[model samples]
Target: MIRLVKVSKSYGDTIAVRQLSLVVNQGEVCVLIGPSGCGKTTTLRMVNRLIEPTAGRIFINGKEISRVKPEQLRRSIGYAIQSVGLFPHMTVADNIAVVPELLHWAKSRVAHRIDELLRLVGLDPLEYASKYPNQLSGGEAQRIGVARALAANPPILLMDEPFGAVDPLTREKLQAQFLRIQQELKKTVLLVTHDLDEAIRLADRIAIMASGRLVQHATPEEILSRPTNKFVHDFVGTDRALKRLSRIGVASFIRPTHSVKLSTPMKEVASVCERCHWVWVVDDDGKFTGWLDRTSLPAANSVRQAMVVGDRDEITITKNATLREALSRMLGQGFNSIPVVDEEGRLIGEVSLGDVEAATAKMEP
Candidate 1:
């Protein structure tokens, strides 16, 4: 929904952005990232007219943004920054109500918007509404800044290092929460950050910038697997392979197999294991119970009585877990295979070493 065509920005003798061109599709999250002073932020600011481009055209939806009044254009787009910049004198509720009030919304509507935004960002409105910015933590204030920007339900969002000021743990939480919110809201987003990890985690498409120019624009997986040049490869770093795994899920590699019930006789367990080295055991309810080792079956009565069940001693990958998680668990525990389970701990399938190896090979350059 946003497009920049041959956009460039200069401040006296220095060029902040070169003739950059890019398009952020409707509801896509596009991240701009690179080294310091590479014009990523400048490109982001140009979209919202925070830093007017000296040359080239910009568009939001279909109309040229340069043709619209600055104030009108900005109000239609949400903006957030590293500093958060919440008004200390205003209550959290009032701070979030800023944009709505500016747009001449009724007091009741503003109040309702404030409450809805707070809840949307995972904050308790009743508890946080009356508090001033000074009374909140850095993370809380940052959340308020986002809520304020989104108060008008703008279809486009411009963010510049929005999570940079928070601690690492808080930053991760915020990124995850923002991703969840984005999935639900689907606003066309243009975010600027120098952190590659952040770009990989949050962006649908990453635009790598260098020396005031757009170097490459591709999906996170594409960029990681097939960087266009030495500059792009070095910028993405050597850990790109590991990062790619974090984008795929365990379900992509899971293999279906036969499962044994805990109530099954030891002889039956051994018979089931005749073709395989091991058998996964489940309870009467089909919840993952444990596994039956071929060597231990002949010495016991039932699968439940003979099963080796001390925490199962088996690594498990949740369906929602990334392939990186599965790989890490397998490598860390030195296991040949790992179980794949659902959220409720029911076994669904198994992931083998071969599965991980094949997936990694497919993603390699």
Candidate 2:
């Protein structure tokens, strides 16, 4: 939905971006990533006219953006940054209400929008509404920044290092939340970051920049497996094979399997998984409880007694989890196979280390 055609920006003798051209498809995230000085942020800023391009044109949906007033353009396109840039003096509600209020939305409509946005970003509206920016945690503040950005329900979002300032754990949570939100909102997004892992995790397409020029722009799998040049290859790092796993969902590799019920006879459970190393055990409700080691099955009377509950929570991957996450869980917990569960924690399928092995092996150089 957004297109940049031969866009370039210069500062005196230096060029921030040079004849860069890219298209961010409708309802897809396009991440711009590179080294520190590679103009990823400059490209992002130019989209919202925060930094006017020295040359070339930007178009949104079919019309050129230059025709629109900067304030109007910004209001129509959501913008969030690394610094959060929230007004410290304003209450969280007032801060989120900034854009809607600017647009002269009705008082009732603005109030509803404020609460809706806060909830959408995982904050308690009633509790957080009166809290000022200074009163919030880093993660909470960033979420508020996002709520403020989405106050107007814009179809396009421009983010420049939006998750960079938060700690790694918080950053991961934010990224996952953004992915869920994106699935629901389907906004055309252009995000800038220096972290390749973040790009791999979040991007539908990646634009790699080098020394103020567009080096390569493609899907993460293509960029990882078929780098256009040495720079692109090196920039993506040596762990490209494992990185490709991040783009694949666990569902794609899940093998349909049976789970023994808690009331099932131990002998029956052993027979059911006679050829397997372990069998997943579920409760009467079919909710996953744990797994049973076949080797321990003969001496056990019930599924509960012999069930190997070795950090099952830590080793479990949701059906929607990336294969990389499954692999990481396995490696971290020394698991041969990890059970896949639905959102309700019911066993759906399982992914093995061999599953990831086979996937990467098929794509091997």
Candidate 3:
């Protein structure tokens, strides 16, 4: 755990941070966010003593950082920054090996750790180990930077815009990888980013600041649903309530699917439709194939003639999808309800627009 007591930083007459106190508990990711020159980067630097605070004490795991040597203190904590900051001359494996080698681990242990971290960040060690930073793409280099940060397996990690440099699609993939890695490693992380969506997706708690002061600090759901002040309210934007949907899982709102196998007779399909206005058609394996409505039942004599053979991808979403995504899909397809499927495309349940509306009503700020 990390704690700050009345921490402040000044540059002669200029103040970068003012009497801010915050805590990031064990196995939590606390994101610091604000506008440019809002002292977000300064606060992150102060944590690792990259920039010393003018007043107040900072402690990590109950040890005050001011009492420790900066070199030793830094080696014990991991840091990753925007622009990647990789040594242009270094290979991927050598970059990841820097810290472990500093800690004087055995040669074989360092070699094994290099491979372990590469795979952890979703890169292949055998292919990437000897590759130079200059030869990699923006996304690949970012992964290497993350691998290097986790190289020492430090209990605490300080990341300053770690995923900000990549394109949007690559950034999302990197964020997912970060979540996967965090789930396994459970490191205490202090991350800085100006992007609210990224913060909402990744942070366990968010710390909002303005003009070098702490504006609000709370869980993402609370901050969005109940902003502490006007500064926080506007900072989170008018879409705050909508963003709350991302926090909800599709499984919570799932309803039993009304479906029939393709081999079923059209009369039987029409019979199944009596329980519901819409009936879904699936293969013998139970994979989603198409759907037909009760209104269309009288137009055909056989199941093949009545069934609307359409792309399943256009009509189905995985059970792992969030309510926000489900809502978006429902609107796009002109659907009041849609089928939920497992990884293998077998229909499991359905989610309706009503479910999304009910869940969203409770998120008003």
Candidate 4:
């Protein structure tokens, strides 16, 4: 939905961006990544005329941006940045309602959009709507910034290090939320980041820029497995194979495994054998609860009495989770396999370290 042809931005003698040409297709995220002075952010700003390009044509869905009014062009495109840029004086709902209200949407419609966008970003409208930006934590502000950008339901989104300001744990969560939101909303995105992990995790295509010019533009898989040049190779690093594993989902490797309901008699749990010395334990509704260590029989009636319970987030992974995450969890917990769950935490299957190993073996260069 965004097309830049030979785009160049210069300030006096120094050119911030030089003849950079790229295309971010409809409904896919295109990440612009490179080193500190590589002009990835400059490239993003040029898309919405935040920093006008000195040379080259910029287009949003085939209409040249230079031909459109700056305010109109920007309003039609969503913009998010590292600092979050939330207005401290404005309440969360009012902040999100900015663009929609600017468009003259009905007051009632604007209010509904506020709640809807807040929820979409995983925030409660009731608790957060009346809050000011100063009341929000860094992560909350980042989420609010995203909600505001998406407030108008723009087809194109420009994000400049959207998750860069947060801590690692919070960054991971924000990335996951962004992925889920993108899956549902399907907005075309052009994001700028220096993080290779973030690029691999989110980009459908990675446009690696250097010295204000496009160095390589390709799918993350191809970029990792086959670098176009020495610069691209070094930029991707020696752990290219490992990085590729992050792109594979846990669902692809899930295997059917034995499981028992929490209500099952301990005697029955002790008899059923998966040969792993443990059986997955779930509730009556089939939601994953814990595990039954068949190796140690307990003097109890039901599986719930004998089984070891675990934190849902800590012990189980969702179908969409990357194998890299699963592998990390397994190594951290010293387990060979991890349970895979659905959105409702229902046990689907398990993915083993062997599965992760087999996948990584092929990626070795």
Candidate 5:
């Protein structure tokens, strides 16, 4: 956990950061985002003591970070930057092992950590371990920078536009990978980025800064659904509603439905059909197969035989997928119902058009 209390920074005549106070809970990703010249970067730097605050106090896990020696405090926290400042001459493994080596970890332990971190960030230790930073792609270099920050397994991570140097596709991949890693590791993260979409996609709580002051601090949904002021609303832009959808999931819209397994006979399928337009056909493993037309089932012997064997291209979303993803799939395929599945591909439930519409309606101003 990290906290900043009425913190401010000034460079002689200019104020780089205003009286900013904020908290980043343990295992939460708090993103700082705003236009250039805003204090987001300054606020982040103050936390690591890279830029000492001229006023107020900062604490980490209840201990004032300023009380600790700057080097010691920094060693306890992981830090990454946009340029990926990897040593050009050092091997990937060596680059990642810098912090652990500084802490005087055993050679064997450092080696093991390097291997683990490389794999954790989707890089092959055996292949990349011996390569220099120049030999890697921008995305790979960014991942290495992240792996280096994480080498010591610190509980707190500070990232400043860590993926900004990569191409859009690579940036997306790294963002997704970082998010997945955060989900598993759950480190307290303070990330600074100028990209609003990035902030919405990755932040557990986003702090929007402006003119050296925090304008808003709220969850992505709350920020989008309920902007604190005109500045906040304008900053989120006209696509705020669409961005809100990107954060919601199909699971939030799914409701209990009369579903039948593949083994269910045609008669049983017909019986449970009720007024529903179609029956969902699922395999023995409970994975969705296709849909069965109720009208056509009367002439068939079994549900499987009656089921439309067409490409199950019908929108299928995982439990972790967002409502916007489901909506995108539906609009792309022109389908009204989308089958929801678990990680193992087992059918869970179906989300309908009415469900999505209702959810969107509830989010309206």
Candidate 6:
């Protein structure tokens, strides 16, 4: 758990943060977001003593952070930034092992921790361990930065634009991976970003900042539908409903009952009927291939030939995709529904336009 009480930071005459108070609960992800120069990142740096508060107090698990040594405080709190900050001379394994090694972990323990962290961030230790930072791509280095931060298993994490350096597609993948890792590890997280979409997608609570002040703090649903002031409302934008969709995942609205395998006899595939008017098709490996029309398929034709098939990226939404993404696919392709697949393209479920509309209807005021 992390808490900041009346926190303020000033450099000469300029105020970086003013009376900014916020709390990040245990195992929760609290995102700080706003326009440029809004003090969101300043507030995060104050948490792990990267920036000393000019006046207020910061606490980590009930102990005041100022009372602890800076180095010690940092070691107990994982920090990742936009630039990645990996030491160019150090190999990937050595970089991840830094915190654990500093903690005096046994050589064997540190080695194991390094490998575990590399895999957690979606890299294979065998392939990446001996490589230097310069050998990695921007996205790969960002992942390594995250891996190093988690190397010590710190209960608290501070991320300042952690995904900001990567391309949009890679940024999305990193966000998805971070969400998955958070679900399993449950570390209390404070992430700073100027991106409203990222905040809505990854936060349990969003803290919106402006002019070095905390403008609003609430769940993404509340923030989207019930902005506290004019600044908050306009900052959230005119498309608040679309922003709300970022908080709803495809998994929540998935309809998994109407799928048939490529090997399924046409007679069996033709027998099923759903109001959506089509059934999803998958290979023997369960990888989603396409969809078949329920009304026209003949008992003699194989399921694959009669069904619509296109580029996987163009047609399918991943199980972790937001309802907004599902709706976009449906509207762009002019479909009543879209299939949801796993990372491997396996059919997991389908989400209809109705499902996304219902989710929007439930947004709070």
TM-score of each: 0.77, 0.89, 0.83, 0.93, 0.78, 0.90
lDDT for position 328 in model 5: 75
lDDT of 2 by residue, 1-365 (tens): 99999999999999999999999999999999999999998999899888899999999998899998899899879999989999989999999998989999999999999888888988888899999989999899989888888889999999888888888868878998999899999999999987888999999999999989999999998999899999998888899889998888888789987689889987788788877877888878777787787888778888888887544467677887888889998898787788888878788888999999998998857
Q: Write the per-residue lDDT of candidate 3 for residues 240-332, one digit (tens) a residue.
A: 767888778799899997888878888788778989888878888999988887888798786667788857767888876678768877898
- The TM-score between candidate 6 and the true structure equals 0.90
Model 5 lDDT tens row, 44-124 = 888888889999999999999888999999887999999999999999999999999999999999999999999999988
Q: Rank the candidates by TM-score, best first.
A: 4, 6, 2, 3, 5, 1
- Tally clashes: model 2: 0
| Better-scoring candidate (lDDT), 5 or 6 | 6
For 1-365, candidate 1 gives per-residue lDDT tens digits of 99899999999989989999999999999999998999987888888887789999998988999789889998989999999988888999988888888899998888888889999988999899999998989898889889988999999999988898889768867887898899999999999887887898889999999999999999998999889999999988887878887787677688896679988766677778899887878888777777777887777777877776735324666676667767777797676777787767788988887877787788756
Worst 10 residues of 6 by lDDT: 267-276
lDDT of 3 at 56: 86
Q: Which has the higher TM-score value, candidate number 5 or candidate number 6?
A: 6
For 54-90, candidate 4 gives per-residue lDDT tens digits of 8999988999999998899988899999999988899
Q: Report clashes for each candidate as comma-separated counts.
A: 0, 0, 0, 0, 2, 0
The digit string of per-residue lDDT tens for model 6 on 170-243 reads: 89889999999999999999999988899999999999999899999999889888999999999999999888
How does each model score on lDDT?
0.85, 0.88, 0.88, 0.90, 0.86, 0.88
Candidate 6: residue pairs that collide: none
For candidate 2, which ten residues in a row score worst on lDDT?
308-317
Instruction: Report the C-alpha displacement of residue 144, candidate 1, in angstroms.
Output: 2.1
The window of 10 residues in a row where model 4 has the poorest summed lDDT is: 267-276
Badly placed stretches (over 4 Å) of model 5 are 252-318, 329-355
Error of 4 at 325 (Å): 1.4
